[model samples]
Target: MPIRMVDDPQDPQESNNDGGGGGGNSNFPGGGGGGGLFNLLPLLLGLFRGKGIIFLLIIGAGAYFLFGRGGGGCNMGNLSDLGGLARGGFLDPKQFERANIYEPLADDNTKNPIPEKANLMAYAPAVGNQGEQGSCVAWSSAYAARTILEASRSGQQGEATKFSPAFLYNQIGLDGCQGSYILRAMEYMTKQGSVPYDKFPYTDRDCSRQPDQSLIRDAGAFKMRGFNRLSLGDRNDAIDLRAIKENLAQGAPVVIGMMVGPSFMQGMMGQEVWQPQAGDDQMSGFGGHAMCVVGYDDSKFGGAFLIMNSWGPEWGRNGFGWVRYNHFKYFVREAYGLEPMPKTGAAATAAFTCEVGLVQVTQQGNKMVAGSYAPLRSISNNVFETVSPLAIGSRFKMEVKNSTECYIYVFGKETDGTSYTLFPYPNANDATKTKYSPFCGITGTRVFPHDKSMTPDSIGTRDVMAVVVSREPIDWYETNRKISSNPASDYASRVNAAFAGKQVSNVRFQSTGKGTMQFTTAPSQNQVVAAIVEITKR
Candidate 1:
């Protein structure tokens, strides 16, 4: 998961497969080419989850507020659809544990001359509506941004079918019409991926129905390679306009989170450019929404970022409108760009099966998983369900072989709620070297306990595990000491914080394997991959 300079899956340099995306393709009804213009919205995190009989009542009432109240052409959105919009754009660092912040280097401006005006609208899918649901996060990132990237990158002619916003929104939110965070949606797209609209479709209420095995596998094709922040805060919490334009100039559409007042929400349809009039500030009632930036023009209304809305094509100019730079600085809170995953199918790990269990062995030679390990595979999906469990007090060693060799930090919450690091136990003799597990190399499978086999303390003992494989070198003394001190504390966050601002790939699954797991360094110095599993009691 190396960070690419441009909008590329790998090798930032231009390739033959970049495709001709100017075809103005679309799959959503009335959605097609942007006609040289586009628009945006914020997130939905705290909206009420209309449920049971109450949900039907709310939907009925909401329809009136959204449609009936606005008696004319193009309703920007109503209080029913615009409430609680600004809830997902990175309010706290601890809030999104796995989210990364990517700042563009000034060298970009020096090396790449940006166009005064740029438009990715031609590459964008037709406008999509989030309805009354607080799922703008999914619509913008999963359905819109991801759709734009896939359709543009695939070299496919004609319009491209949309990836399901519901596939992401339903899975991430708590329930009903409650919205989700862009961070979660982006992470899901990068790792698990989203199913096509034909598979899951869109829903304004209820979050039931998920991907099946077949759909899950197919989702791999639409997975995003990764995502990076376009602009965060410079001065006065406003994002850098230059960086936003730089990315768009490269044909990369940016997904943004912004605040919207009544002026924009209640009366934005006819405005040439979206700049709030009097009393347009984001007061408590003003909603925060998510949208896509498909184009920008320096000359239009004195510089603007053309936004693509999820309010359907009836709003603005075909659901797209320009926002002045100053207006954007005042309201725009977050902006991000996505990279496409190579169409070479899913990750290599997804193509194979693994078994991670501990065997009561009395020897030590294979420092790695002995048999199934392949030379080419670097990372794997999940090992297995339950490593054949061991009897109480049995001496055992983990028998395993991973295609990729890397250091493993075994930390997990025991069934009783105790937190502990399983792999690198405190080495009293030498704090530098782990007491139980150390040395992540593939010359030969090493000993499970380094010198002796591990024995369980009790018969009914069980602990769920989070196996973290990092490419960054660790200060063993500090990591082990810090994690060991808080066995029952939130040490997992500490382990996670170590990889902040770095690319992280999370693939959690259950584990059933060799007796004792070991540790090693990853093959490359990029991306921290972590997997979670439950330990079955034997």
Candidate 2:
């Protein structure tokens, strides 16, 4: 594992994720590289140029995030003060990291006499200590930065608002050892949201900790609207700083990964401010370490970025320090920022959600009967259910009846992890097939797989179907092609995004085609309900 973390000085064995190194937990499609992958313009014009070949190419390899590739990073000698610095391999699980590099705004401010700067420290949570573990990615993202965003949005502060890095790190890191990727952490937060610190504290490093229903609910309460990566492509330092400052100016914290070596380890300790020193580049690197830029100072250290460290108050000034621009330009590996979703007026967006069910088919004497309901246990908050749609000829459908004008979507995930839109079936005419419908403009139930009963493609194939509704008009073909990178996670993340934090409840199901797939699908705290049915080979 290429892990870069500040080693816990007291515990020499467990290196702090403060230094990038090996270790992680969650599975990755290595997709989420950047928005570049989903360039709407060209993609809209020439979608699936080779049919499914392009998507498969994207899913198979990544120009970035394909870790375990490079080896032998900066060398950090045996350091007793901080835990062992990982030798650098896969530091952040998000190594499949893709930065959304922002272009310089039209009113470029880099030319201003006073350098561009912003301090988001007010919105940030208290500095945390990761102790002797390689969880800096978690501490930086979930524990600190995400907590800041959530607390600011909800106006609920103190310990209750803080998200648990342990909840993220243990699950995202390798086994329970140490190390993780920032991208994986973001995916978890976006798809499942983050639980409060109290629910799963950092002291417990059990990466295998399974969350119960309540924890799952709490985790789903809030999610990032989305994230943007910082790109400094062909830009001068001043312009690059402006883009970063712009995000911080919005009061959103920036998560950063930087190189830490012998000089970094030695110089960072008890230092008022840190700048790259002579021979610092020559020394072996302990590993890449992750941190959060709460603010920046144009006047400090030749225009420095104010950093939040998880090494605790003992390091830096009360768990904070300034890293100069030169250091950032040379050492920093990646940076990503996330925005918060609205707390209200959510209903105005997309309040509609779909209910799904398995249709039991049997021959009743002389007549063939289709559409008998199967049992699905209704969970309180989230839509969680399992059905065994065994054998061939198994039927399924999704019902959406709504007062709101919403668009419905159905997706099918194959055994190989690739997925495609199932409902609003694509037609031959490109112009007419502009969008799929069963548009929820009028009152009445609309069933997906409506044209014909949805039957299992093959018994050996376990097909999973999800019914979803979005108020925003999503180009289904475009979105489907975009999410094909890692359908297992990305597809669900897209649906969760459509749900828009609605609390889902009372999802109903009628086994027969008469009652069909259904749900009240109301947003409980803005959650739109949707569930997946696994077609089994019984």
Candidate 3:
């Protein structure tokens, strides 16, 4: 696991395989040079550029959540005292760590008048402390977003609205206390809204923290519209720094990462001004750390970035200090600019309607009797279709012929013109398991239900839209758990709005006919095995 500055201090261990030395709970895909045997299949599949490979991997891997920690784990370090400047690595999880001694490198005696300077503290709320948890990423991200939200409000300007970092740590599927990626934290705000601190206050970093009725009610109630990625190609420092300065100058607070070491710690403690020298990198020792870059002073200490630490107001100059520009680039791993979603009265009542049709399908019995349905004449287009209409509350069994290894997905569309996942319910068998439908072949007789209800306000005839996806939209399923158990009207509304008209040619199934023996009964040179059946109320 890579040491998170907030987890454990002296004994900083790697949290997980991040291609860096550390202990971790989640598995990094290609950490430490070799990605295990998992690398072989992806590497070979990489040659074939299409979405089918992605779908195959999902089914092949089974349900990672069922076995080990799903996705990679994060290592959060508990930062104690503040430190001054010392050249070290940013949160580059995949880099070599070479030990180096800590020393004072520069004097804060520059007299040049800086032209561009912005202090985010003016718009930000009170500084916060992360306590004993390794959640600097969460704290900094929440703080940054809160600052933007409060600043953007016309009437409540400077009235800081505390957003719950605890809610994000607990709900967003991140490993607790273990540090998480900075970008992931920002993205969480967009996907699942964060609430005011009064709703979900900060607690110790542990999985046992449960949500109360109040917490559940406010979950995803308020969200940021999106975030700006200030990263450059190949982790290019120069390009990233320029983007950071531009955003900061515009009064936007930025979230950044750093490699916390002895000298860096000493500066945070208010012992001395940090002045890092070039080539004194410390990537190996302590792991990654995240903080907010609130302002910049081009004339101070040979130009520096003013930082807001999550150690509360007593840490630095009221929980703030200046860092060398070189150290900012060297120690800062990633930076992001946040934008708050519209919260005005008009924005609240805004409604959207979809142009597409809804679909539903039902499998009546164990076998598809010869007279019940006709066989697909050919698999020419990306989508395969059936002429019959499907009804809501109807049950359907799907079968895939010719290939025993192919996976299947069932989708439902309502009268509101929205689509939803209808199979692979929560705790459902893996797509590769024979007991599961859509994914499994001959032995799979699982039934799919059109459970999504028509909103009382909806006025049109309800219908279901069926789509057979080759790949498992794992993230989709994970985010909207209801899609599996009982599809909700809100889930359909959200998904349709988010993915409307989004072209996904690469994600289609690609097991086409080869040589003389066709992969399927499709005359087209290529074939993507899929079916879209009209669903009506049974």
2 against 3, candidate with superior TM-score: 2
lDDT of 1 by residue, 33-70 (tens): 22111111111212434354466456545543333312
Number of the top lDDT candidate: 2
Q: How accurate is candidate 1 locally (lDDT)?
A: 0.52
lDDT against true structure, model 2: 0.54
TM-score, per-candidate, Cα-based: 0.48, 0.49, 0.44
lDDT of 3 by residue, 61-103 (tens): 6423111222121132323323322121124322211111011
Q: Candidate 2: where is the Cα deviation over 4 Å?
A: 1-104, 110-115, 156-160, 233-240, 346-473, 476-538
- Rank the candidate models, highest lDDT first: 2, 1, 3
| Minimal lDDT window, size 10, model 2 | 1-10
* Candidate 2 local lDDT, 262-292, one digit each (tens): 5555566778787555434432233667788
Residue-level error in angstroms, candidate 2, position 210: 3.2
